[model samples]
Target: MRKIIHVDMDAFFAQVEMRDNPHLQGKAIVVGGNPEERGVVATCSYEARKYGIHSAMPCRTAKQLCPYVQFVRPRFEVYKSVSTQIGEIFKRYTDKVEFLSLDEAFLDVTENKKNMASATYIAREIKSAIWNELYLTGSAGVSYNKFLAKVASDYEKPNGLTVITPDKTQALLDHLPIGKFFLVGKVTAEELKKIGVHYGRDLRNLELSYLVSVFKKRGYLLYDFARGIDEREVECSRVRKSIGAETTFNEDLPLNSEAARQVLKALAEEVSMRVKGRGVWGKNLTLKVKFSDFSQITRSMMTSYPIVEAKDILIYVEQLLNKVDNLDEKVRLLGITLSHLLTDEERLQENISLFEYMESLR
Candidate 1:
């Protein structure tokens, strides 16, 4: 059996803010932009969650939920720096680290640097290291495969560790809610309820063909997950396929030439910053526009050279925007995407200063 551990930071952004400023501890705090502005909550503290506040919630709604809640703008650079520190800590045990995001990862420590035979012990040590180095707590879940490891990690939140041994897997999964299982989304959960499938055991009772008929391609994967059988490996060397940023608006923006330009410019800047932060450059720029009718369209351009800077991205963004046919329609969303990426190793060697330039923005 393969030993995998999933590590998830507790309320990452909010926790980091509280760690830096101790006065914010034990208070209902939110990390995002001004509530009065077109801001949304990136993450909120457990105290804030009591008021029904959560990530991706509108800041205004969060404020109404808890009038005393404190809101702070996100510090992406600081968060990225902390993420780098966390990555380094994971590397100390095993090179088999797969980052799900800045705050979560799966580590395959079957053969670790310390030769630790017990996965549970390695998990405890890793959690200890994170706390010692960053003064932040992380939860770890150790199991025989990725699915159970991920499920175990999230079973408890804000600094909890759970282990699902081979013997315990089936019983634990049997009672677990269908929605709690990975990839069984809200829509899928509701669909399962119609057939009296509300838990893992209920799902397992269905014939494989019935599941396949209902969920199509995803049905095969769900069948394996329900039985606690996941053959997927812990891919250590994961590559980002694309980098993009998008905004959902409180009000639709008219497709007037100047109005569209302004939205595209802002989106391009955000995308450029993220691309630079990841040390990647792309040859294709895609402009995605969602109209008031909920219809969406994307226009892309393949450039001769890899693009990274906001100004360069804006140039292509303008070209693509001009290609969009419906100028009179109102837009509800605007996004910029960079594709056909080349990492720092592939292109930065030619221009060392370019990498330095990207870092300087942070």
Candidate 2:
């Protein structure tokens, strides 16, 4: 067996709160809301889900569906801390653990504690440890590879565990919808359905040559996944590509110079904080402006030296203000993004010091 395991926490945030506070048990607990506001749900406890409420639904609509739902705002700092503890647990099983998100990860234990025997055993121990230590439950899926492992893990949810042996692979795949395949998203799934390609079995019957001819680049991917073949690996760690920030306005702007400059300065400050906090510097600055009518535009400029300060980010923002003036349109949202990253060695050679870096570059 290839020995891959996918572990995903069950209602991560809401479960953590329920575990810590006993009184909240057996009640409908939601982890994101302001009750009367327009924000959507982040995650809801299984109790709230009993009323058909799920994550990302509008809070108002969720409340309407389950009127007795107890709304609680998300506490991200707590979630981050809990995620770290869970990551430590996975590290004990294998060094080749890849975190897909705070609540889920994939582990390649081919050369690990179990060592070619049974992958399901390691997954069971990990799930047991999480329940015993953190007072939360998680689901596990074991298979020959990452793709099948992930599919198996979600097959049985909420403290459930499922395994897809090599023998059962074809049978398990026969009934799975094309949409259930990881990369077959909403748009592609609709396209597949239109052509009567609803299940993996249907896709497997279609030859790769014809699929590629019709779909071009994506056709090959469809053929590969249809056979339950995935060449992807688990990357446990990597650097962040970019640091940026965006904020949507409660009302549209009047498109005056005063309004544009004021909004740019505020957005630049938000971007600067993110860049500096990450301790990374950027060489390119891009401004994303969304109009009241939902049209979007982006303009970018490259700086000679990298910047990680509020003052310099504002300078680029000032430069963009002039570029956007001719649009003659009302503004609804403003965002600033920092990209074109530089490594630490490059930063040291360029002499990009913290003190003189911001203002001197201008």
Candidate 3:
């Protein structure tokens, strides 16, 4: 059995805001995009949870739920620092750490220093360390596989711990709601209910072949999950396939030769740090320009080999800039993308996408 532990930070972004500005603690606070416009809530505090406000909900509706709620913009810098701190804590446990996002990650401590044997202990220690180092609590779920480990984490909220032992799998899964299982996302859960499979027991009793007939390819996956039999490894998912960052200014930027270069340089540096930070290399560089009127155009190029180094990416970005017409006018935003990719010609020649030839990573 693989020793997998899923660590999820509790209300990560909201918690950070609360920590930095203690005045927000114990109040209904939300950190995300604008509410009056087409904005949505990224995260909310426990206090906001009282009003049924959750992440990704339209900010307008969230305001309807709690008019007094405090809304704050996202602080990526602060969150990144906290994420790094949390990652350091995971490294203390094991090197086989797979970060799912800023808030969640998986750690395989099968050959831990202490040979702790129990994944539960590893989860507890990790959660404790997060609180100690970052002044925040994290929920942990430990199990023999990634499926159960992730499910265990969501069983509780805000500083909770749960374990799924091999022997206890059957009984534990029996009563668990189908909605709570991994891969059975919101849409799938509703679909399952329509099919009369509301719990693990219902799905487990389902014939694999019959499921295959109804859900087709996904049926095979449902069958495996029903029995708590997951073969998926704690994949050290790539830092990010491609890194691109964009910003919308409060005002439009002029389209002078110097202004364009200045904007392009800034965007290039920002995107460079994103992709280069992960040590990812790509052959294709794409530039996106959003005009003040919201008209967008993208220019792309394919290099002979991948450009992992930041300077190479920036140079390619500078070259691609020549493709855009300067007389167009002031721009609202500029964006850059470094693709872990190959040219279309290369793909046709190889008869497959770069991913397939690279490995079965996809």
Error of 1 at 298 (Å): 4.1
Provide the TM-score for each candidate, comma-separated: 0.77, 0.71, 0.68
Which runs of model 1 end up more than 4 angstroms from their true locations? 190-196, 213-216, 240-298, 301-322, 327-362
Tell me, by lDDT, which candidate is best.
1
Q: Candidate 2 lDDT, tens digit per residue, 1-362? A: 46899998998888888887789888898876465744456688999999999865667778999998988866656776788899899988789988765688899988885464678888899999998888889999998888898898889889989998878888778789888997787768898889899999998999999889987977887787778787778887643577676667788875555766665665565565445434457989998888998988888899867887667988887787678764567788788899976655668867746546666778
The Cα error of candidate 3 at residue 27, in Å, is: 1.0
Best first by TM-score, ranked: 1, 2, 3
**What is candidate 3's local distance difference test score?**
0.77
| Model 1: per-residue Cα lDDT over 1-362, one tens digit each | 89999999998888999999999999999987567854567788999999899865667889999999999877767887898899999999999999766788999999999999999999999899899989998889999999999999998887999999999999999999999888897779999999899999998888899889988988898898999999889887665788887877798878775766765666665676556545568888888889999999999989767888778998897788789888888899888899987765676564676768788999
Q: Give the clashing residue pairs of candidate 1, or none.
A: none
Residue pairs in collision within model 2:
none
Give the clash count for each candidate: 0, 0, 0
Order the candidate numbers by lDDT, best to worst: 1, 2, 3
Model 3, 1-362: lDDT tens per residue?
68999998888888999999999999998886567743556689999999999865667778899999999977766776788888888888788888776788888888876678887888888887778777899899889888888888988988999988888988888898998877687768988898788999999988989888888988888898888888877676535456675666688887555766655655554554444333345667888888998988999998766665445776887678778777458888878888764333444555455557678763
Best by the TM-score measure:
1
Local distance difference test, each candidate: 0.85, 0.79, 0.77
